[model samples]
Target: MDDKAILHQYLRTRRDSLLAKLEGLSEYDVRRPLTPTGTNLLGLVKHVASVEFGYFGEVFGRPREFALPWFADDAEPDADMWAAPGETREQIMELHRLSAAHSDATIDELSLDAPGVVPWWPEERRRVTLHQILVHMCVETAHHLGHADILRELLDGRAGQGSGDPNLSQRTPEGWAVHRARIEAAAVEAEAAASAADTGS
Candidate 1:
């Protein structure tokens, strides 16, 4: 595949990886804030979907076909980061799928150098091309996928790009326990060493 196709594929991969973090999780598990900053799986998906459409759709002058109520002038701040009580998981997932389709269309139709402007960006740096946006979105999506990885692991001991992905060490339950204990011991040792050095003892 060419450069654009390659970039698109990478972005698609990150999107899939992010979505996979929700598998086998209950609604509460997916929506519950995993971090003090309120980062959650469903919220991450919603935030990415919103930005994907804005970057690929509005930036290229291809107006969105649907509404994003969170973006309205009177909506609560950071509303896109969390689903309201009335918003179902299906709705958020559908938005993600639809936004991905829209982004894919933009990627497919435009050359890498096709110019666009980001109105929401600082005026001096708003000008961009399809290539820049593709790279930006890829990085952004992967960043959230990293968060999803940790959140999913916190929810359950699962981790990796997808189900049964062999990217992680194949440790049995008892082995994992031993591994964690070893790491914890190392951390304590390191802390003690650091304190001793700080005290010049």
Candidate 2:
């Protein structure tokens, strides 16, 4: 594959992983915020869809057939970062997948050097090429995938980098607890030493 094709493939791989994180999870569980910042599996997917739609569709002046309610003028800020009360898991998942398809079309139809404007980006970097937007979107998708990975694992103990073979250590719960205590103890020791050095004690 060419350079653009390779980038698209990598982005799709991460997209699939993002969706996979929600698999076997209930609507409540998938949408439940697991972090202090309200990070959740479903919310991360929603955010990715919005990113794809904006980066690929709006940037290229290619209108999508569907409207994104999350981007409406009156929509609450960070609305894309969550699924609403009435929002179903299927709906969010479908939107993310559809957005991916839309982005893929943009990637396939345009040349890597095709010029476009990023309205939301800084003035100095508003004008961008297809290659640039593709990379940006890929980076956005991958970053969110990391968040999704952590949320999924915390929600269901399903820890892995992605689909296929797992990346989790094959350790029992007892072993993991001991490992965690050791790390905590080491951190405490290091902090105490640093404090003493600062005090010249």
Candidate 3:
């Protein structure tokens, strides 16, 4: 495939993969932070949506009409990394879907060499080609999707990249449960040993 086609495919595939990891989860599960650092499934989705709109929509001058609540002028650049209470799961997902559509439209309408400006970048350089932006966005989307995959797995033991079927061993459910319990017991024992060592008890 050509460069534009390749980039578009990559971005869409990654975006869909991230969404798929969230399947069969309730809103609370999606929004729950899986890490001590506050990384969550729904939060990652929100982050990607904001960046998609910012890079593909705003940079191309087809800015989103709806205001982003977490966005601020003088705040940290990564403000989109977390979800505020006011933002619903449906709203975040819709924004991501809409942003993807808009980005796709812009890509369809513009040539690889079509010039656009990135306002937040260096002022001396006011323009970049559509091809450049597409590649960058593809990388960004793929990176976040990787994060989403890990977070989802940690939440419920689901694993794998993209929208592929989860692994299914021939072992029965009871066998799997026994194995899981053994692993959990081992982890608990290890933690207790480490704690005892630390305390000199």
User: TM-score of every model?
Assistant: 0.96, 0.92, 0.76
lDDT of 3 by residue, 19-89 (tens): 78778888788888878888888889988888888888888888988877678666665557766778777
- In angstroms, the error of model 1 at 98 is 0.8
lDDT of each: 0.92, 0.87, 0.83
**Model 3 lDDT-worst window of ten:** 162-171
Over the stretch 1-201, how does candidate 1's per-residue lDDT look in tens digits?
Answer: 999999999999999888878888999999999788898999999999999999999999987988899999999998999889999999999999999999999999999999999999999999999999999999999999999899998888887854467788878779989999999999999999999999996
TM-score of predicted structure 1: 0.96
What's the TM for model 3? 0.76
- In candidate 3, clashing pairs total 0
- Model 3 CA deviation exceeding 4 Å by range: 74-79, 124-126, 161-201
lDDT of 2 by residue, 1-201 (tens): 999989999999989988888888887898888888888888898889878888899899997877788788999888999999988888888898789889888999999999999998899989999999888888888898888877876886667753335566677778888998999999999999999999996
lDDT head-to-head 1 vs 2, winner: 1
Q: Specify the highest-lDDT model's number.
A: 1
- Cα displacement (Å) at residue 93, model 1: 0.6
RMSD of each: 1.3, 1.8, 5.2
